[model samples]
Target: MNTNSTIRARRIADDIDALAGITEPDRPYTRRAFTPKFLEGRKWLEQAMRDAGAVTQIDAAGNLIGTIRGAHPDLGTIMLGSHSDTVPDGGRFDGIAGVIAALEVVRALRDQGTVLDHTLEVADFLAEEVSIFGVSCIGSRGMSGSRPPEWLQRVAGELTLEQAIADVGGHPLHSAERDDIKAFLELHIEQGPVLQNEKIDIGVVTAIAGITRIEIIVEGRADHAGTTPMGARKDALTTAAWIALGVEELAKALASGEAHFAATVGEFEMTPNAANVVPARVRMLIDARAERREDMERFVDELDNGVGAIAAKTGVAVSAPRMVSDNLPTPGDADLLDVLDGACQTAGASHRRMASGAGHDTAWMARITKAAMIFVPCVDGRSHAPDELATAEDIALGAAVLLDAVMALDTKLQEDI
Candidate 1:
């Protein structure tokens, strides 16, 4: 399996270079969705698709799609892609690599003079990164029919999201759901050190972890910091500190056995401005993520029970954990995962199964189709920053794996779909 030869590392490098140049000159890789820079990047992707012999169009959701007709157009489509837009200073390869790699697969197929049975589509999903519209996965959510209609009215500057969609060649009011996608595949950089540290070539994503944010408030009587005895006065700040420590201990225990669990006291606030005054109140927000529903449930239960004891011991009133936000985990399709595992083997790539700690467009796409994603290694698992890195050689290998998966899906789905 000569992956470098098949995927054409030079084309991949050139595509990255071209798109990397369309960023804000000062920011050096910033291309927020609905911005001019983002649109320019999209235009480049559209033309690249055309050069690969794909018929291109923008969906109502503003997803840029490039389709190459297959031997049997009546059959369902095999979709491969990732987003192209970036966060301010977000590195060059967050979602861009996947899009370019998908394009390369199509070009590689043409080079081999092979035609698939199912039509292939390469997508550059709009705003996979949070955009000026203040929401992420805008294109994917809209495409899957999960995007709230109210979100269409979300405002950014003088334009509503609906207007912005139009500016980018989308028909927001005429939003449509995709029913013909036989399977969807997204190739992304791991954006973490596991792949690189372990010397793995690919990560077969098992699931996209769900995130839940909980707010906990700690209240205590205000007293003079200098006069109040350590045992006599209840300090909200001290109580909050204890709770934060408890959160860490519990999270560490949960993380130990390993189904991708993490909890952080990400937000904290204290009342009273004076340095001499004891904190009258403290508020904390916990950002917890779990790959399995049961793991989250257990973590919440343990935390809730621990909170009562903590407040009792501290003599400070601690409110129950209030869930400010909660979203369930999205598991990859088993059949699709099997296909990816087979793809890795066929491509001569070393890989492992893992769960994504971050959210992705694939999670939304899963709502409507048998969708899954793969991760290639990035330097230090860094992303959403200027220093994030993934080599062209590594990306090409990932593309080869994706190409293999596409071929498998094309043949495998013919009987099922």
Candidate 2:
């Protein structure tokens, strides 16, 4: 289970640094999908893939794929990748780290003069982050045949998503599901405190949490702030504040339990700009994720009852939480999870099994083929921000683990076939 001799930490650092440098000069580390800066990054990545001896092409789904043919092509493909797009001024390591690690795995295999039984493909998925078009996971969805036809008509500026795909070298009208992939792997920053706090080198993800967004609105009468008594005014803002605090308390209690759960009042708005006037309306959007559907059901039920009590105590009207969007949890492939765990042991990497609180392209790919991913700790467990950090050595270790996993999968998949 020795680490591959060809896996180079310096090379991983260089690739990360190079991608980090492609961001906007005014906004550091911002190579957002469907932008000029993003195209520049793609150009560099494509050239890098070619230099590493890959046959590179953009798929019909707008996914940039670099393939290395294997000794036995009939066994199908073992694909590795993640999205390359970033959130606004988001950290360089979020999605970029995974794509680079996959590319490095391909390079390491080539350097060792080893060809496996399954063809290898490295993908830089398009628009995994919410794009200018207000949609996400475009490439992954398209590749998996889950993208609705209406999505192609989704508009940004004067161009439809269909045109955007064409601009990126994809034929959206012809995008189809890939059945040739025998397995899929990805590596991403942990974006949480568990791994770093536990001092673990790798996290074998058990599943991706289901995401739910709930909306609530509180309504009350506006009155003169100075003239109205403190107790007499029916303030919507205060009622909403109470509900938010209640959410925190409930979420804390749930998180302390066995399964992973988190809820955040990520978006909020208050009406009535006058300082002297009482607030009339307040809307809150809660982002909640749960590993178990039952947990999410419990949360919603408790929230509904809590809001009812608050409405009775106060003179304001609080609407029941309404579902904005809900995505079911996706469990990682059990066999692939075993493969990744074995790879960790083989690479001598310390690791533990965990669930991903954030979504990834792996979830979509899971629908088409056996798929799983690993997480490397990021400093402070922070992501979607400019200050996110992960050490070169840590990422390099993850790359080595991925290389081992790919090698293992090369044979393990053939047995299944």
lDDT (Cα, tens digit) per residue for candidate 2, span 133-172: 9989999999999888998998888989999988989999
Candidate 2: RMSD over Cα atoms? 1.2
**Candidate 2: lDDT over CA atoms?**
0.91
Q: Quote the RMSD, in angstroms, for model 1.
A: 1.9
TM-score between candidate 2 and the true structure: 0.98
Report clash pairs, candidate 1.
Answer: 191-381, 192-381
Top TM-score hit: 2
Candidate 1 lDDT, tens digit per residue, 1-417? Answer: 453446898999999989999999889789889999888889888999999999999999999999999899889788999999988987599999999999999999999888999999999998988788878898999889988899989998889999999999999998568998889999999988999999999999999999998999999989999999988998999899999999999999989986999999999999984799999999999999999999899989999999999999999999999999888999999999999999999999999999998899999999999999999999998988899889998999999999999988888997674
Instruction: Pull out the clashing pairs in model 2.
Output: none
Model 1, runs deviating above 4 Å: 1-5, 221-229, 273-276
Model 1: per-residue Cα lDDT at residue 193: 96
For each candidate, what TM-score against the reference?
0.94, 0.98
